[model samples]
Target: MKTILITGASSGLGKAIGEYLFHKGYNVFGTSRHPEKVLNSPFPLLALDLNQPETIGRCVGKVIEIAGRIDVLVNNAGVGIMGPLEEIPGDEIRKHFETNLFGPVEVMKAVIPHMRRQGAGHIVNITSIAGYTGLPFRAAYSASKGALELLSEAIRMEVRPFGIKVCNLAPGEFATDIASRRYYTELSPASAYAEVYGRTLELINQQVSGGDDPVMVAYEIEKIINTPDPKIHYKVGPFLSKFSIVLKRILPDKTYEKMLMKHYRL
Candidate 1:
């Protein structure tokens, strides 16, 4: 059985993916900040805090110690930050990048050498459709994912020679715990964006509540693992969300911006 290591597996997409793969007979090692909080998980859970980069090496070491080899590494841990770029504090922005981008990069660095030694492995980075096009009020989150998307592309080429495959899995809004987990900037009455920010936040919550089931993403991940050669970029979600990536490629910049503005009522 192929051994799989997944980060942020306490809940949401990460949890779903881990469970799916576990039932499929893969040796799955999952990570959460407090693994004990997860009730009755079939697989072993390790403690991992993406914000604390120093803990990443230890977390990866634990997985290797238990699994012997990691055939797949899923960089699925991430946090969401929502706010106007201008008003979002520097600390908040740094925190957002620390969890979403730097954390995954650190995990990648820790796992690559082992995969290289094994002669083959797959690394899946969970990004977002927002990475392809910026989202209003989610500037930091969008930017972080976008950075990961590009980084995955570059690393894909660099690691292919080592029999290591890197894929950027970009999903649109999904029915996950993201709504509750996301951090929002304080909106004061004097703030210019207060009214619109409120409306946008509500809209975002509604969309996420009604979005695709995260199990769909897990299914895609399963397929990617089974395929002999997987695409570097896999956009998973509903039709419009997946199409948005294609639309961005074909539409002029101004047109795309107008469409987004209208959709968000910004």
Candidate 2:
């Protein structure tokens, strides 16, 4: 059985993917911030905190020790930050990048040597549609994902000769517990963008609550893993959401900005 290691498998899309693959007969190893809390997890769980980059190598080593060899890695662990760029503190922004970008990159760095030695492997970085366009108040989150997408593109070429594949799985909104997990910047009562931020926050919550099932993303991931050669970018979401990428490519700059503003009622 092919061995797969997935990050953030305690819940959300990560959990769904782990469970899906386990049922399909793959030897699945999953990571969670609190592995013990995931009582009913079908696969082996490793404790991992993306904020602590130093622990990444140890966790990957543990997987290699048990699974013998990791055939695939799914960097699905991530956190969200929401607020106006100005109001969000520098430390919080750093934290966002640390978890979303640095953590995954470090994991890749740790696993790449093993993959290279084996002469074959696949790495899937779970990015977001927010990467394509900056959201009204989610500037940091957008920037982090955007950077990850670019990193994936560059790394894909670098590792192709080694028989290792890398791709960005950018998903649109999904009905996950993201809202609860997100860190909202503490807004001051006198802040200039307070009212608009409040409105935007409400809108974001509503959208997330009504988003598509995360299982859809899991199914798409399965397809990518099964394909002998997958594209560098695999977008998964509703029709309009996926089409937004094409729109961004064709639409004029100001027009795209206007559409985003109108969508958020800015």
Candidate 3:
């Protein structure tokens, strides 16, 4: 059986992915910041707080100890932030990059040597559609994801000779605790962009309420993990978000901004 490690597996899509893969007979090593919750996992679990660089290596250690191999590493642990760019402080912006971008890169640093020795492995960085198309009030989140997508793209080439595949899983809106965790408490009590904040929050809430099922995302992830040679980028989930991304891609800058302003009712 292949061994796979997934971060942020305590709940949401990560939890669903862990459960799905374990049910499929893969030796799933799941990680969360809370070690106690590891007991709740059906598969083997380890404590891992991405903010702490050391925990990543230790988590990797756990997987290597039991399974003796890690065929896949899914960087699914991330946080979100909302509010206008000017209103959101530098510290908050850095926090998003630390958790969503650098954290995964650190894990990759720890795991790549093992993968190199094994001669083959898959690394899936779970980014977001926000990474590709900047959404209102989520500048920091989108920036972090943009950095992630770019980093993964570069790493994909660097690791090709090593027979390692680095892929991006950009999911559209999905049902998860991501909203609660991603919400920027530090940037809250919005005064500078009060109008924008309230309006964007309402739009976000509606989307979250009707988002796609977590299991659907889990299934897509499982497919990515199983494929012999998956594409460098995988886009999945809600159609509206996907359509929006395409519109942003094809339309002129002013036109796209107008559409956004109209849709956001800004």
lDDT of each: 0.91, 0.91, 0.86
| lDDT for position 252 in model 3 | 99
| RMSD to truth, every model | 1.0, 1.0, 1.7
Model 2, position 240: C-alpha lDDT score: 83
Stretches off by above 4 angstroms in model 2 are none
- How do the residues 125-241 of candidate 3 rate in per-residue lDDT, one tens digit apiece? 999988996778887888899899999999999998898989999988888877777656444454767766787788887887689988887788888877888898888888888
Q: After superposition, how far is residue 202 of candidate 3 from its true place, in Å?
A: 1.6
lDDT of 2 by residue, 1-266 (tens): 78999999989899999999999899999999888878999899998888787678789999888877989999999999999998899999998999999999999998999999999999999999989988899999999999999999999999999999999999998898999999999889899989989999999898888999998888888888888899999898878888888999999999998998998888
For candidate 1, give the lDDT: 0.91
What stretches of model 3 exceed 4 Å from their correct place? Answer: 185-192
Tens-digit per-residue lDDT, 1-266, candidate 1: 99999999989999999999999999999999998788888889998898787778898898888878899999999988998889999998998898999999999999999999999999999999999888899988889999999999999999999999999899997998889999989979999999999999999999999999999999999999887889989988989998988889999999999999999999
TM-score of candidate 1 versus the correct structure, residues matched by position: 0.98
Candidate 2 minimal-lDDT segment of 10 residues: 48-57
